[model samples]
Target: MIKSRRKLWLFVGLFFSVIILLTLLVAPSRNQLMSGSTFGVAPDGYAAWYEFMQERNAPIERWQKSFKTLQQNYSDNSITLLRVYGKSAQFAVSKTEREWVKKGNTLVNLAFQGRVTEAPFSTSHETDFGAVKIETTRRNTDSFKAILKDDFGAIIWQEKQSEGKIIYVTTPYLAANAYKLSPGNYDFLANLLESSGGNKILVDEYIHGYKDKETQEIEETSNVFAYLLNTTLLIILIQGLVIVLILIFVYNNTLEKKKI
Candidate 1:
């Protein structure tokens, strides 16, 4: 009995161990990836492109192709990322953009990008100097917002409010790494001021957003083993009664034989 109980417990432990290993491998990451963080060099292609083309000197089509990589990372249902290559003026030339007209300088949105509604850019919703001027606080993991898109990190887009020029940036990597050489890169940093007059950059020392993985508790099953344990315990309690009844029967049989 002791050996059997020990074996049962050993099997149970082994089964539980296997389940734990499988759960970890199958589960998605809790908060593994970080954005706006630098790689070995520049953070993204857009920043690199801006760095190259800022002086009209480091022009390369191959270099521009890297920026396209950023658009492919977006989820199709929630976000729609549109990239326009070459000079920014060519954006107005498309037939679909006929409804859109330049107001002083900013490109007015005439059509919707297939969302719930055909929403255009609203000045009412627009902030003083943030990601975009949209009123709703939706989860946009693209280069639109001042916050870094949390998918393995990507391009950094900047809108200069004073100049009314939106810079699709890729220059921060140089600024971040070996900043002493190109100290001027950060001289005109993108302004991400909140409507309440506070800095929006959330650079915390500890793992701020990295929360612990939510593990589901396994429900214990009252199976054959549990039933056996109950039966065994009941047997131990009534064991004396069973022994006494057997002895009484043997004693009665012996007395009858003696009388015969």
Candidate 2:
């Protein structure tokens, strides 16, 4: 009787394990939870713009690694779009990134909330993009040029640094999915990028929690479990082994019961 009960319990466990595995395989993805990511479909995401650029055959790429890695294989006259929120340490521009920009690359820094470290310098100048007019608050400076403005003052400013330039747009909304409602925003961004004379355009996805396999490997060098978890084939093999083991147990229990 004890043996029969044990067999029943094993069978039950096996059946539930199979069900759980199947459920996991068919479960809905949680990519939507990742805001601002190119894979995300959220309103704040750049998926739409990314797709649009791909469709246009534009020389654009999603940068899924760190700026330090980017520097190792740096391309001259490239444009990098970096979206910034507040002045948090997580999003703070590193010294390496600054150096990368100095090497004849353009950095399009977008700050939607308009809260960031003060620009190197700026000027009281009015610049308009189609029907959208932008104004600068600070006194006129030779190096800083205002590109867009609103009642809140200069929403976009450009500053030259060494061989490259940094264009600060006080609003990330200009390139977000919301731009679909306003065609002018799309035109303004397109023109701005084109005018930058960058040979390639790179959207920084590393800041949005997307990292390449090489990056994951570097971060998880000492973690065997993490390495196994990241291997799809190994995971599938492990699941298959669990099912096979359950089958063998059930078969052995059935023969033992028959003998009894």
Candidate 3:
């Protein structure tokens, strides 16, 4: 009986572990294949590109904490790659981050969210990055310089911000899983990063729900009620309460003597 119970518990443990693992493997949203995460394997993921860069000995690293921490710790000239869903106000850069960029950091903004855009004007150009030839579109205004363009507009563009600059790529999936099919993407991205003139490359994974232990602890401590209300923590708490209640009911029903 003891052996059988042990086996059952072990099976349960393994089953739950597998469940958690699978959950972590999936992207946060159906359309977003962990867009900015190097660990993503979906069509829109950067895993392929990240691996390619790593093999070539690129100076790259993943930033899995808040940008505030980044500004505080990194004083040197660095390049950050970021992906935003749209031109909405919610995706606007914060004042502190703008200041960080103004201090001479290059921020590569992958702007598209796997959707088509209606541009006011358009022009086509064949951009040769490395040995790869990409047909791009011109989609920027007088304020922004078009680097590469497609039918929808600029695939890559440049905007000056004091001593630093912000490079915008219309498609977030430029060097995604598709890179396996179109190997030119690897070369294109490699060339882009190399030309950025940064000491290091930082891919922002903090935007993808990844945080260091200290950051997590600090966030939890910042709001007691919010921490208690976390979905995962709430689920665990409820399950534990249910188990305790079941144990109490079983004890009362099976171990107590007859009252009358």
Top lDDT model: 3
**Residue-wise lDDT of candidate 1 within 30-58, one digit each (tens)?**
32222222112333213432353344432
Lowest summed lDDT window (length 10), candidate 1? 101-110
Candidate 2 collision pairs? 134-148, 134-149, 135-149
For model 2, what is the error of residue 12's alpha carbon versus the real structure, in angstroms, after optimal superposition? 29
Q: What would the per-residue lDDT of candidate 3 be over residues 1-260, giving only the tens digit for each residue? A: 46645655665565567546645653255345365467777765777888889999988877878887887888875655554332221255667777788878888876542234465322323447433333223344444676765456445788788978878776555677755666666777777777777888888877766678888998878676764465475456655665565556545644443442
Error of 3 at 53 (Å): 0.8
**Residue 133 shift from truth in candidate 3, angstroms:** 8.6
Per-model TM-score, in order, reads 0.24, 0.59, 0.64
RMSD in Å for all candidates: 21.8, 9.7, 7.6
Best of the candidates, TM-score: 3
The TM-score between candidate 2 and the true structure equals: 0.59
Q: How high is the CA lDDT of each candidate model?
A: 0.30, 0.63, 0.64
Candidate 2, residues 1-260: lDDT per residue as tens digits? 78767876876687677757865774434442245556656666667867877877777788888777777776554665555332221244567767777878888876543444344333233235444322223322334677765334456778777887888775444556755565555557766776787887777777666788989788778578765566578556766787787778878778987998
